[model samples]
Target chain A: MEIRKKRRICLVVAYDGTNYQGWQIQQNGNTIEAELNRALSALTKEPIEVSGASRTDSGVHARCNYAVFDTAVRMPGDKFSYALNQRLPEDIRVRKSYEVSPDWHPRKCSSKKTYEYRIFNDEFPDPLCRLYTHFTYTKLDTDRMNTAAGYLIGEHDFKSFCSIHTQTETTVRTITDLSVKKEGSLITIRVTGTGFLYNMVRIIAGTLIEVGNGKYPPEHIKEILQHCDRSCAGPTAPARGLTLVEYEFL
Target chain B: MEIRKKRRICLVVAYDGTNYQGWQIQQNGNTIEAELNRALSALTKEPIEVSGASRTDSGVHARCNYAVFDTAVRMPGDKFSYALNQRLPEDIRVRKSYEVSPDWHPRKCSSKKTYEYRIFNDEFPDPLCRLYTHFTYTKLDTDRMNTAAGYLIGEHDFKSFCSIHTQTETTVRTITDLSVKKEGSLITIRVTGTGFLYNMVRIIAGTLIEVGNGKYPPEHIKEILQHCDRSCAGPTAPARGLTLVEYEFL
Candidate 1:
């Protein structure tokens, strides 16, 4: 008998993480990855272990995310999205799916990731968007927040911006872009980078918020980066408003 | 002894209707209106009975909904939004609250109401958006759908579009505007009217969908309207994706 060839597939997924622990495999009941695997296994009639490009934290949202899985089922690879989405939960969907080389690893591929943080600056919370955004008070200086974010766009030792408990050996990462804009009572902070340290985006948001509120000078970010001391960074913002927008393979 | 006058309050509320039985006060386990009343009553230390502009069906969303109530509480009406929102569930919120004319009736006021219907026109369902949108197959013709919607505009006896179980005494209503557009795989249908018959928007969408799929000609809508028979209309579309975008008071 001939050996079965493994077919690799790429996926674009969107999720509301309020109910999930995170994307990784865990002993607990709910996980985006576990749900995906279960859905895929049911669809493909086999055990399909998938690997996600980023292990996004719980309470995060994603408009588009990438994941890869290998399956030896009889179905064509192009039809995988339709098949998998049918079995998945409504809040997490496979936007699209495609065939890729078996060696294409979702994590190892060279690319950039984009994340967005939303702040509801209004005095009252928007109940409809409560689960999808963060609410905050205390006036923020847009100019100062913008100025502080400028210091983050480039290669740097991001140790100060990451959680002290980050498991990665090196906290060095290249930030490609950062921006802050306000629309009505909503302030949006967007960041794109080659990679990120643990809790980096949320920490950056919190630090920038301090600059906006005049609690910290815009130039303070440079010092925080130079010191590489976790204590120098601002507190971690809440996780509700963080969204993993996308990952691009280039 | 002098009697303190009662204050009439108006509120702009928003909610995620996934778990509740819609906006009305129901004898069932929970309702958005009941929850808001509970929170408001608890905060003001008074019995409160709030009336909503629309009794939205279960699973329907509202971005800006109006409600009015009479109370002799001591709290300032402007701050009612802040106070009510603090105690409301994470899924329901009061965006703004202010004192209104004692005669102001949320449902009686003649205003343009805007409603939007969303359909996921993809081959597969999105797990993340499952609870928030409706999924349908068969390619849709947006231009044709828009053309058909034109027949719904203007004053008419809309008895055929109203559900048989509607409690309203009159089925005559005016549909000021109707439009349909497709953004990628998402088809959004927006309707503006002085008022809608019971289940009217969903029925209109369902009937238009038939036209989009070529099962019925655009002109067929005119015939259905003329017949004045609910059976002549298409099936009522799902309630999940419909949203009360706003109400204009002039």
Candidate 2:
């Protein structure tokens, strides 16, 4: 009897995420993981499951999300993108796929993730940008937002910026870069970090928005971090404004 | 007996046309005009009909499409934008509203209209931009497209570029400005003209795309214009790439 050795494959996926209930599989609604599993199963003629690197929130988009699966399929790894894309919906696309060592795992790898939160700061909301941007009629001060973001850099206890529902054991994380840039009527907040707690980026965005709108002083972020309480930070920004821009495995 | 004078109101409308069946009222499917009429009737307690400046095709977006309607409602013209927006779907928005003279008409007046056609030229399609842009895997030559567009910027018989089903009496029109620009992986063709025949802009986009792809020489546009036959030009481009950018009454 000959035994077929199963190989591990890594996939870089991109999705609009408007119709998805997040990256994790849930019983109540559609999700990116569920769709990927269904498409992979249909393509390989087996019940396939994939583990994602990030469990993105509902309505959060992703330009590059990492996922790994083990399969016994005989097809070439590079061809998986084309084959899986044929079975996926228009809103979801497999950007790239490649073979990985059997011992490699997505979640256990050291990676740097970059997120972008977009805000359309204009008197009226742009209908064309409604799907990707969070619209605000109030004017925002970019300088103040940038000042507030500076305090969030380096290793710190991010409990105040994490959602209370998170099950993670530790709230310590390191933010490498955080910037607030304004171009015309659009304000973009780009944050790069080693890892994130649940809803950490969204909470940071919400806190920075408060500073931009003059509700809080830029220096107040230091106190929020010291408190290390979820109630110390601002509310979580809407999920629609957040997007995972890049994921670089170290 | 008190008499309320009926005033003609002009609306500057904007919409994401992905889910609409064009600007004109139709019985087959949902349309921008039908939604407007429905909202207007509900707001004014009477039947309302609007005449659009351009009957844009399905999947054609608009930043500023003009529509005029007579209303007996006592609401101020500027307030209509706010009121109508509340009832309209998120894809459609009333940007502004103002009162026009009773004798003023949108289509009858001399005006300059600008349209933009966007193309995403890359090895792979971007799912985030699929609804708003046309995607082509081929690398396009911008210099050739610009040269072809230069030949289109003058008064001439555009029968070669007009759709065969056009109901217009004449195919002659004056193009004020035509330019093709490439930024990153996206190409934008901007055209401003006195008036456009049915499917004229889309046909022009298609013909220029052929020039850019090396299918036709840049100078071939001159011969196409002189032929004055629809078959002499390239096929009409998809409607998703075209957008009505501006409409300025002279």
Q: Which candidate achieves the best TM-score against the true structure?
A: 2
Off by over 4 Å in 1: A1-3, A139-143, B1-4, B123-129
After TM-score superposition, what is the CA distance of residue B107 in candidate 1 from its true location, in Å?
A: 2.9
TM-score of chain A of 1: 0.96
Tell me the tens digit of each residue's lDDT in model 2 across A43-153. Answer: 999799999989899999999999999999988999999999889998998989999999898889899999999999986788888888888888999999999999999
lDDT of 2 at A210: 92
Interface RMSD of 1: 2.4
In model 2, the runs with Cα more than 4 Å from the true position are none
Write one digit per residue (lDDT tens) for candidate 1, span B1-250: 8677898999998888888888888787588889988987898788888999889998899988999988888788898987877787788878789999999897777789999998888776654456667788788898889989999999998998999998887888998889998988889999999989889999998998999999999989999999999999998999988989979985
TM-score of structure candidate 2 = 0.97
Q: Quick one: best lDDT, which candidate? A: 2
In model 2, residue pairs whose N, Cα or C atoms come closer than 3 Å (at least 3 residues apart or on different chains), thus clashing, are none
Alpha-carbon shift of residue A205 in model 2 (angstroms) = 1.5
